[model samples]
Target chain A: MELEALSVGQYSFIQNAYSFGFAVMAAATLFFWLMKSEIAPAYRLAITITGLVTAVAAYHYLQIMLSWGAAVDVTSGEVISTGKPFNQAYRYVDWLLTVPLLLIELILVMRLSRQETIKRTTVLGGAAALMIVLGYPGEVSSAGGLRFVFWVLSMIPFVYIVYQLVVGLKESISQQPESVKNLINISVYLVIGSWLFYPIVYLFPLVGLEGGAAITAVEVGYTVADIVAKAVFGVFIFMIAMRKSQEIEGTASTVSKPAAAAENETSKPS
Target chain B: MELEALSVGQYSFIQNAYSFGFAVMAAATLFFWLMKSEIAPAYRLAITITGLVTAVAAYHYLQIMLSWGAAVDVTSGEVISTGKPFNQAYRYVDWLLTVPLLLIELILVMRLSRQETIKRTTVLGGAAALMIVLGYPGEVSSAGGLRFVFWVLSMIPFVYIVYQLVVGLKESISQQPESVKNLINISVYLVIGSWLFYPIVYLFPLVGLEGGAAITAVEVGYTVADIVAKAVFGVFIFMIAMRKSQEIEGTASTVSKPAAAAENETSKPS
Candidate 1:
C-alpha cells in the first residue's frame, strides 16, 4: 500500500493518541516517584523501573505528537513534507527502551533470587527488544509481503516473551503472598492480551484495510493497547508492590513477637 | 467571530481530546466500581456517584468525538455539514448531569448526616447545573457581546458554588481525621484550580486568539482541566474515603478491646 493522504479523522486520531500517551506516561512517572510505600528494596526497584519506562515513552510520544502536528497541511487535510519528517520511528524507539525495562520491572518485583532474576531479565528483555526492532520493518514497509515477513519474524520473539511470562514465571509467582498472586497472573495476562492488538494493527493493510479507515484503526488500536500495557499495568505493579510490602511486614512482626502479632491480627477488621 | 473552516490540526486536536476524555472517564468508572475497599456505606455511595459522573461524561464525550469525526471534510480540512450536525451541545448536556453529581459525590464521601447531605446536594447541584446551562449560549454564540453576557450570567452560580465549597464545607472538612483533612482541603483547591481553566478556554477568542490555534487551545485546555478535575480529584476522594474508613474501623475495634487494639496499632509499620 502506497502512503498518500490521511483524512482529517485519521490525522486527529493519531495526534490525539500521542497526546494522550504523553500525558498519561508523564503522570504515571511522577506518581510512582511520589507515592509513599514501604515495599522491599526489590519492589522499590520495580517501581523505579516502571517510572523510567513511562518517562522514556512520554518523551518519545511528545516528539511523535509534535511531528504529526507539524506535518499536517491544515488547508488540505494532508500530511505534507514538514522540514522535520513525521517520525513514526519514535514509536519503535520508545518500545526499544521501555519494553526491556517493563520486563525487568516485573521480574524485580517478583523478588526472585539474584541468579534467576538476572537470567530471566536478560532473556525476556532481549526478546522484547528484538520483537520491537523486528516489528519496525513491517510497520514502515509499503509492500504487503515484506510487512508480513517482518511481522511473522517479530512474533517469534513475542512468543518467547509470552512463554517466559506464563510458564517460566509460574513458580515464582506461586511463591508470592495469596493476596497478590492472582494480581500478578492478571498483570501478565493483561500484557499478553493487549499486545496481541499490535500485530493485528500491523497486518491491517494486508487484511484489506487501507487509507483513512485503516490509519484510524491502527492509531486508535495502538493507543488503547499502550494505555492498558503501560498505565493500567503500572497500576497493577504498584498494587503488587504494596501488597508484598504489607506481607513482609506482617511476617516480620509475627516472627519478632508471636503473642503481640496474634493479638494485632485478631483486632484487624476482616 | 463567524464560525468558518477548521484546519486539519484543529479537527484532530478536538477529536483527540474528546477521545482521550472518553477513555479516561470510562476507565475511571470501572476503577471506582471494581476497587475493593472497606469504606463505609456512605463512602461507597460516593464511589458509586463518582463512577456515575464519569460514565455519563464518557458517553457524552464519545458523541462529541464521533460528531467531530463525522463533520470533517477529510480532503478539504473543513468541518462540513454531515446531516448529523456537530453537537457542541453535548458538553452542556454532560455538565448538567455531572456537575451537580460532582458536588453531591464530594458531600456524600464526607459522611455528613442525611439532612446535611440533602441540603448541600440540592443547593450545590442546582447551582452547578444552572451554571452549565447558562454557559451554553455563550459557548454557541458568535457575538462577543452575547458570549460575554452569558459568561457573566454563568459566573453568578459558579461563584456561589465556590463559596459553598470553601466556606460551607469548611467545618465539615475540618472534622475529618488528621491524615485526610489536609487531603480534603487540597482536593477542594484542585477542583477550583482546574475549573478556572474552563472559563479561560471559553474566552480565548476574546483574548485575540482566533482560527485553528484558538480552537486547538480551547480543546486541549479543556481536556487537561477535565482530567485533573475529574480523574485526579477522584483519586483524592478515594484516599479520603479509605482514610476515614480506617479511622472508623480503628475506633470500633479500640472501643471493643482497648489492649488488643493498642497492640495492633503499635505493631503496624508506620
Candidate 2:
C-alpha cells in the first residue's frame, strides 16, 4: 500500500494491458451475442453465457482502468501513487461472477442430456464460485503466510475443476462430432492453463517481487491470462457451437462419428 | 433528507416485509432451479431465467434489509437513523438487473420464432432497462416537480412494455393448449397489475404523504409488489413451463389444439 514511484515503462505496461483486455472482452461479447442466432437453438444458451462472461469481464476491465488512473499520477514525469489504493477487488468480483458462467458455457455447449446438463452445471459452477471465494482473502492480505494458506485452500476447488475439465467431462467431449471434439478438448486445457496465471501472479510478491514491479507483474500477468482464457477460449466455444450447429443442420449423416455412439453416450452417467 | 425517527410499529413493518420478500425470492429461486429438469428442454431456459430473477431479487432484498437495519435503530425505543444513509438505491439496482430478465423470461417461454425471439427479447429487454434507468433519478430526488418530469419520461417505456405484454404476445397465448392459455394470460395481467405498485409508491410523497408515513408506504408497497411480480409471476412461468413440457412430452396428440393452427402461429411476428 506504500506510494511506490513507478517507472514510465512499468506504468504504461499495466495501462495498455488493461486497455487491450477491455477491448478484447467487449469485442468478444459483441461477437458471441451477435452470433447466437446462428447456433442451434439447443446450443444458443451456451453462446449467451459466453457473451455474458465477456460482458462482465469488459465491465470489470473498465473499472480496473479507471481505478488505476485514479491511483497513479504521472503529472510529475514519473508515475507515482496519488495516495489512493488501486482497486484490486474488481478482478475477484469479476471472477466471482463470470468464472461460474464460464464453466456453465462449456456444459451448455456440450448439449448433454437434460439431467446431465443440470447436474454438470450445478457442480462445476458451484465449484468455480467456491474457488474464487476462497482466493479473495489471500488476494487482499499482505502477509505472505496468510496468502499462502488461502492460496492452498483455493487450490482445492481449482484442482477439482481441473479434474472435471480433464477427466470427468472426457466422454461428453468425445461424443461431440469428430470435427469439434478435439477443439473442445483444447479449450478445456486452455481454461486450466490460463487459470493458473492467477495463482502465479498472486505469488509474485511472495517470491521477491514488490512495489511497482509487483504491481506491474500482477496486473499485466492477470490481464494477459484473462485475454487468453476468456477471449481465446470463448472463440473456441463459439466455433464449437457454430460447427455443431452446422453438423446438426447439415444432415447428421455427414459426421464421421457414428450417430448410434452419440445416442448411446447420452444415456451414460455424466 | 434529515433523519426521521420511526415508531416501533413503522420499523417492524418494513423489517418484516423485507424478511418475507427475501424468503419468497430465495425460495422461488430454489424451486424454479430444482424443478428445471422437469421442464421441456426448449422451455428450460425460461425456467432458468425465472430462477435468476428470483435469485437476484433475493440478494437485493437481503441488502435492503441490512440497509434498513443499519439505518434504523430502536435501542433508545424510537427508531432513528444511525447517520448512515439507508441504501435506497438497492431497490432500483434490483429492478434494473431483474426487470429485463423478467421480460426475457416471458419471451423465452413463448418459444416464438427464432428471429422473432431475438427481436422481441432485444427490444423488450432493452425497454425494461430503459424504464428502470429513467425512474431512478426521480426516486432519489426530493424535488416533486423534477420527479414528476422523470415520472412522465419513465412512463413512455413502461407504457410500451405494458402494450407488448398485454397485446403484443396475444397470438402466442392463444396458440397454447386450453389448460395454460388462460394461466399465461392472467400472468401477463399479474405482471401489469403488479408493476403499477412501484409508480404508485413513487408518487406517495408527492401526493401529500411525507416522512415516516411515506417511507413506510413506499417500502411496504414495493415489497408486496416485488413478491407478486417476481415470485408469483415466477411461479406462473414455472407452471407454464411445466404444462408445456407435459403437453410436449405427454402426447402431442392428446391435445385438441390443431397442430396446423399452432404451426401457423409461429410464423407471426411477435
Candidate 3:
C-alpha cells in the first residue's frame, strides 16, 4: 500500500513535464484560430494536424486523472484491469488523443509534398493502421504478445514515415519556404523520437523485470517524452500551421501575376 | 444449462458478426494494392480513406471475436474480463484502421477544392479526432451510453464534412470535373448512412433487444453500411483521387505557355 501510495508522487513531475506539450498544443490552436481568415491551401494540412494533436494532448492530460484518481481502487490488484468506466476512460482517451494526430501528421506530409502519389499514401495509411491495431485494447491484454505484434506492426508505419520525411523534405525544399521546411523536419524528428520508447516499453516488461523503480522510470520517461514530442514540439508544428496562410498567399499571388499581366496587355490600346 | 446454452449461442452470433468487418478490411487492403500504381493525386485522399475505412470495418470484425469469444466462460454476474492483450489489440486495430482515413479525407478536401482555409481544415481535423475517440473500445462499453455518445461524436465530423463539401462544390465548380463531384456526393451520403446506425444500435438495447435475431440484424446492418461507405463507395472516391494529377499538370503546362509564346515572338527573325 505504501509503494502504491508513493506512485502518486510522480504526478507533479508528470504535470511539469507534460506542461510543455500542453502549452504547445494550446498555442498552436490559438495560432490557427487567430489567423483563420488568412491561411492558404498548402498549410491547411499542417495546421489541422497541429490543432488535432493539441486537442488530443489536452484530453491526455485528463487521462492521468482517470487512471490514478478514478480507476485506481486500492482493493483491486495494483495492476488495473480495464473493466469499466475507468479503464475504458483511460484507453478511450489514449486512442482519441493519439490516433488522429498520427493520421494528421501523415496526411500533412503527403499533402504538402510534391509526390502526391496514391500508392505512397496507401502504403503509409496501411502502415499507420498496423501501428493503431498494435496499440488497441485487445493487444493491451497480452502484454508480451501485443508488444511483439505491435513492435512488428508499428515498424511498418514508422519506417515508411521516415522514408516519407526524407522524400517530403526533398520535395518541400523546392516549393515551401525555409521556415515551413525547418518546422516540418523538427516535427517529424520529434515524432520519431517519441516512438523510440515503444521498443523500450515493449522489451522492459518482457524480461520478468520487477524493479519497481526501473519500471516507473521507464514509464514516466516515455510519458514525458511523448508529451514533449506530441504536445510541446507539436506547438511549433502549429506555428507553422499559423504561417500557412502567408505561404499560400505568397504562392498564389506569384502564380496569378502572369495572368494579371496577360490581362493588362490585352486591355492596352494597341 | 439451457439458459447457458442460449447465452453461448448469443455470444457466437456476436463473434461472427464482426468477421464481416474484417473480411471487408482485407478486401480493401487488397484493392488498394491492386490500384496502387495507377491513381492520380486528386483521388489520393478519397482512395486512402476508402481503403482505411474498409480496414476499420475489418478491425471491428476482429474485435467481435475478442469480445464475444471471451464472453462465453465468465460467470453471469462477473464482468467478462479478458486481460490487457485483448483490450489493446482490438482498440489498436480500430485506431490504425480509422484515424488515417479521416485525416486523409480532410487533406484531400483541402487540396482538391483549392480553398486553403486554415479554419476549415482545423475544424475538420477536430471533428475527426472526436469521431476517433468515440469509436475507441471503452467508449462503446456501455452499449446504451456509448451508442449515444458515438452518435453525437460521429455526427460532428460528418456535419462538418458536409459543410466542406458544399463550400468545395461552390468554389471549384469550374476547375473540378463533374465525375469527381458526383463521387464526392455519393461518398458523403454513404458515410452519413453508416453514422445513422449508432442511434439504431443504441435504441435496440433500450427497447429490450435480445437474442441472435435482433443483435445479428444490428451488427450485420452496421457492418454492411460501413463496408459500402468506407469500401465500395470509397472505391468510387478513389476514382476522384485520380483526377488531380491532370489538373496540376495542366497548371504547370499552361502557366508557362504565355512565356513560351512571348519568347517565340521575340526571337522571330528580328
Show model 3 residue runs off by greater than 4 Å. A1-8, A11-28, A73-122, A137-139, A143-146, A167-169, A172-175, A241-270, B1-176, B185-270
Best by lDDT: 2
Question: Which lDDT tens digits does candidate 2 get at residues B1-270?
Answer: 333645655665566567657756875675577567556799999999999999999999889878876776664345666888889899899999999999899888878889989999999999999999999999899899989989999999999999998788888778877767877887899999999887777777688777776777777788889989998899889868866775674355423323222222321222
lDDT for each residue of candidate 2 in A1-270, tens digit (9 for 90 to 100): 443546888888889999999999999988987787776554666777787788768877986798788777786677667654566777876786679878988887876765577689889999999999899878777789999999999999999999998999988777666788888888999999999888787777788777877777777889988888888999999998888766555544554432223333333443
Q: Considering summed lDDT, which 10 consecutive residues are worst modelled in model 1 chain A? A: A255-264
lDDT of 1 by residue, B174-268 (tens): 76556777888988999889989877777887777887677677777877787788877887888887776666566655465333343344334
Judging by TM-score, tell me the better candidate of 1 and 2: 2
Superposition error at B31 for model 3 (Å) = 29
Off by over 4 Å in 1: A1-5, A36-38, A76-84, A254-269, B1-270
Give stretches of model 2 more than 4 Å off. A1-3, A252-270, B1-270
Judge candidate 3 against the unseen true structure and give its global Cα lDDT, from 0 to 1. 0.51
lDDT of 1 by residue, A1-270 (tens): 223457544454465556556655765675565442334565888998888888898888778767775655444334454554566788798889988888888888888889998999999999999999899988888788999999999999999999989998888998987777878998999899999998888788888887767767777688678878887798689878966765565566544333233333632433
- Model 3 is docked with a DockQ of 0.05
Relative to the unseen true structure, what is the C-alpha lDDT of residue B57 in candidate 3, on a scale of 0 to 100? 62
Clash pairs for candidate 1: A12-B12
Complex DockQ per candidate? 0.07, 0.05, 0.05
Q: Rate the local accuracy (lDDT) of all candidates.
A: 0.73, 0.78, 0.51
Looking at model 1, give its docking quality level. Answer: incorrect
Q: What is the TM-score of each candidate against the true structure?
A: 0.57, 0.58, 0.49
* Candidate 3 per-residue lDDT over residues A7-62, each given as its tens digit: 44443443454455456555655664455334443344445445555554554544
